[model samples]
Each structure stands twice: as structure tokens, then as C-alpha cells.
Target: MSKKVILITGASSGMGKETAKALIQEGHTVYTVARRIDHMQDLKNMGGYPIQMDVTNENDIQNVVDTIIKHESKIDVLWNNAGYGLYGAVEDIPVDEARKQFEVNLFGLATITQKVVPYMRQAKSGTIINTSSMGGKMYTPMGAWYHASKHAVEGFSDCLRLELQEFNIKVVVLEPGVIATEFGEVMLKNISQFSSKGAYSSLTNQLVTATKKMYDKGQGSKPTVISKTVSKIVNETKPKTRYRVGLWAKPMVWMRIYLGDKLFDKIIMSQLS
Candidate 1:
């Protein structure tokens, strides 16, 4: 494979960081960005460039694209992987907080893509990989906003795939299952703060305990699984429009598809019990 210039967001930790390392190891010119540039020191040491960027900031997004274009002339791949799970009952999470979730997960991703797509169209060759989740396809308790954002990502990618085909720009969506990242911890904190003493406190407590057990037992796949999957996607001449990786990702999506809403709800609720 030719050495291609790649850009990845949310590279401060977890899947994004792992993907950056893998791509650099493959001899690609990688520029990784996240709010925490200090966290990417190791990536820089490994010959990958790191930029400090907040995905919600348009100026930051513009700066990142301009810098990459100025340096590499063309970006061969764009990985939109910056997002966080906001876990709390829809009734309890303030609308402002919910909007913030979309700002980072959906709108921010869309903005970055908009800035980069023109360049890719001019070059007539590029790949755009978006990070959705199993939750995008299936709903879970206390993740209303997060799931909605990811579901939006799925639809967004589908339409973009069709539109970009003429331009030779590929749009792929990644549906990651449970990966051992800061996700569990951050989610637990949010749910507790938002709903622990509210009308859904009982369900909130149950979910909190269950989530703790799942992650504490190391049941989630390692971040490297996603990294390897991304590497595969990046190198494929004709990659699938969607790739599902990590533990429980495939099975959960399947259950949601075949089991119907009532049965799927039963299974998910049974877990909380």
C-alpha cells in the first residue's frame, strides 16, 4: 500500500489512540487530534503528529484540515472517532446537556467531514470512516441522547455513501460493541449524577450496578481489537460500508434486528434484574 496521509480525531485515548499507533506502524503519515494533546505524546514519539482540537469548535476543525492540507497536500483517510456516551434518563438529562451530546457526537463530526470533503472531492479519492456503536442500532436504558446521536450517524453515513460514490470518497461506519475504555467509568458517573435520586432511581441503580460488574469483570474487548479492525478497513480496496467489532457488538445488533422490540426489551430488562 502506498503511504497515505490519514487524520484521526479523539486520539487522546482508547480506540482512536490505538488506531493511530497501528497506522503509524504501517508507515502511513498520520495526524491525530484530540482535546488532550498531552495524552498523545507517545504517538508523536512514534512518528505520528498530534494536534490539540475540540471537535465542537469549528475553528479547531478548520485549523486541523488546513494544517494537514498544507503539510501533506492530501488526506487519504479521515477517521471521525471523537464521541462520549451520556448515560441518564431522557427525562432527567437537561436539554442543554443532551444538545451538547449531539454537538460532539453528530454535528461536530459532520462539520469536520464538510471541511475535508471538498479537498477529497478535488483529489477524487479518499475514505471517511465514522464511529457509531452497537447502541446506534440497538437502544439501551439511560443512553437516549447518545444512542440518538449514533443512530443519526448511521443515517448520515448511509446518505453520504451514496452521495460520495460519484466523487470516489468512501463513507464507512464502525459499530463497536463493548470495549474496555473510559466509557464505562464516564457513563457511570453521568448516570449517577443525573438520575440516581430521581424518578428512575431504581432503574438507574440497577443499571449502575450491572454496568460496574460487566466492566469490572473485563468482559469488554480491548481497544486494540478496534484498532486492528480499522487497519483492515483502511487498507481494503473495497471495504464494507459498515464493520462491527469488539465483544457483544454483533450479537446485540442481531438480537435487536430479529427479536423484535418487545422481546429485545425483555432481554435487556432481564439483565438489569
Candidate 2:
């Protein structure tokens, strides 16, 4: 595998952090970016450069690209991984919260990718790997906003893949299933804050009960599982457009695509049992 200069966002925790480490171990130069500079210090210690960046801010996004270029001269891979899940019923979540979710998850990712594309296009080679979720292709009750944002990412990635093909810029979408991380904790907190006691209280309650147990039992795959796939995508000469990794990722997505929507809906609701 050739040594590539890579930029990864949301590197303070979870899959992003793990991927940064794996890439560096594979002899690549990696720059890790996130809002919590302190949290990324560990990543920096592992031979990765950590930059404080809030993905929702356009200036921050541009600065990250600029900083990498100033040092590395080019960006070979962009792991556009900055995002969060905002879980709540569609009617229960505030309009502002929903929009904010898109701002961070969709708009920020798109902006950063756009900023880097020019550099990639000039070089005539690059890859943008987006960390979309399995929920992008499937949905569950009380997670309307989160699912919507991921669904948008899936579509956006497809469009990007087609457009950048001519430039020899590969666009890959990562659809991860349950990975052991703070993401679940954060999502639950959001749901509790917004939908715990309203018109959708029963639905929210059931979701919380089911999801909390699953997370507590630690059923999700480790972050390293995704890191392996990331390494493969970067190393392969002819990488696929999408890599659905981690536990239950493929099964969940395939079931939804082959099975009817009603059957999938029942299976989703059965989680409450």
C-alpha cells in the first residue's frame, strides 16, 4: 500500500479515532480533526496530528484543508466523518434541532468534501470516504431526524461518486451498523431531552427501553472492525463505492432492500419485545 496523506474528522472518539491509528500504523500521514482538542491529544500521541475543528463551521472546514495542504502539499484521502445522531420523533423534535442535525451531519460534511475536491481534482486522484450509517438505508421509530440525515448522505454520496469518477476521484460511503461507541449514549440523551414526555412518549419510552439494553449489553462490534475496512479501502486499487461494515450492517441493509417495507417495520418494532 502506498503511503497517503489522509484527513479524518470526528477523530476525538470512536471509529474516527481508531481509523486514524490504523492508517498511521500502515505508514500513512494522518491529520485528525475535531472540536475537542484535549480529547484528540491521545490521537496526536500516536503520530497523528490533531486539529481543533468544528465541522459545522465553514471557516473551520476550509482551514482544515488549508492546514493539511500547507504541510503535506496534497490530501489523498478525506475521511469526512464528523457527525452525530439526533434521535426523536419527527413531530417531537424542534425544527431548530432537526436543522442543526443536518448542519453538522450533512452540510458540514459536504462543505469539507467540496473544499478538498479542488485539490484532489488538480492531482487527478483522490478518495472521499463518508461515514454514513446503516440507518441511511433503513429506519426505526423515534429516530426520524437521525435517519433522515443519514438517508440524505447516502444519496449525496451516490451523486458525488458519479460526478468525481471522471476525475479519478473515488467516493466511498461507509454504512456502519452498531459499533461500540459513545454514539448510542449521545443519541439516547437527545431522545430523552426532546421526546421523553410528549405526544410520542410511549413510542420514545419503548425505544429507550429497547436501545438502552442493547447498548448496555455491549453487543456492538469494536471500532477496530471499521478500521480494518478503512485500511482496505485506502489500499485497494479498485475499491468499491460502498463498504457496509461492523455488526449487523450487511444483514440489516439487505433485509430492508429485499423484504417489503411493512415486514421491515414489524422487525424494527419487534425490538421493543
TM-score of each: 0.99, 0.98
Candidate 1 per-residue lDDT, tens place, 1-273, comes to 878899999999999998899999999999999999999999999999999999999999999999999998999999999999999999999999999999999999999999999999999999999999999999999999999999999999999999999999999999999999998998999999999996999999999999999999999999999999899889998899999999999999999999999999999999999
Candidate 2, 235: how far from true, in Å? 0.9
How close is each model in CA RMSD to the real structure? 0.6, 0.9
What are the runs in model 2 whose C-alpha is more than 4 Å off?
none
lDDT of each: 0.95, 0.91
Which candidate number would show the highest lDDT if scored against the true structure?
1
Residue 269 in candidate 2 has what lDDT? 85
- Assess candidate 1 and give its lDDT: 0.95
How badly does each model clash, as a count of residue pairs? 0, 0
Across residues 26-114, which tens digit of lDDT does each residue of candidate 2 receive?
88999999999899888778888999999998888888889999999999999989889998888878899999999999999999988
